[model samples]
Target: MHIEEKQIAINKVAALLKNSGKFVLSIDKNKDGFIDTGTRKITVFPDTPAEMKSYIENSGLLLIEQFETEFAHIFIAEKG
Candidate 1:
């Protein structure tokens, strides 16, 4: 998708999550993708949108909890 399309899609997803009081957790499946952890291959929960990893921080939901797996990040958010 183009940049605009991608932004729109992200916005839509953020709206849905925010409306439902849900937050999205982006996972660094590669592990090395995140700098905080090095070669550990463990799941990490990140609060900041550092390293240009994800824009879910802009989802407009409050981070309540987080979970991690080999494939994805699991996040729970509370409505503000």
Candidate 2:
């Protein structure tokens, strides 16, 4: 079976977040995004979904939350 573009995109996000302990809050907007972990906050901007996913998945973590806006996506996930 072939994956749809949107699912592929989401799965990509999942994979990266799975591997990487960290993830850029929101990417593709060209502006830095913010994330809060109850104890800490982080801001980042990944060049692309692929890039962000690479970082997130490679870091060795799990769980991902995506906030969808008309302009961009907001992703939150666990850190290792």
Per-residue lDDT of model 1, residues 11-78, tens digit only: 56666654456544454444432344465544333333342223444645456676767765565655
TM-score of every candidate: 0.37, 0.40
Task: Point out the worst 10-residue segment of candidate 1 by lDDT.
Answer: 44-53
On TM-score, the candidate that comes out on top is 2
How far residue 63's Cα lies from its native spot in candidate 2, in Å, is 4.1
Show where candidate 2 strays beyond 4 Å. Answer: 1-24, 28-46
Write down the lDDT that model 1 would get. Answer: 0.48
Candidate 1 ranges beyond 4 A from true positions: 1-7, 17-20, 23-54
RMSD of 2: 12.1
The local distance difference test score of model 2 is 0.53
In the range 1-80, model 2's lDDT, one tens digit per residue, is 01224345545655655444554465445454655669986664335555555555554544377666766666676755
* Counted clashes in each candidate structure: 0, 11
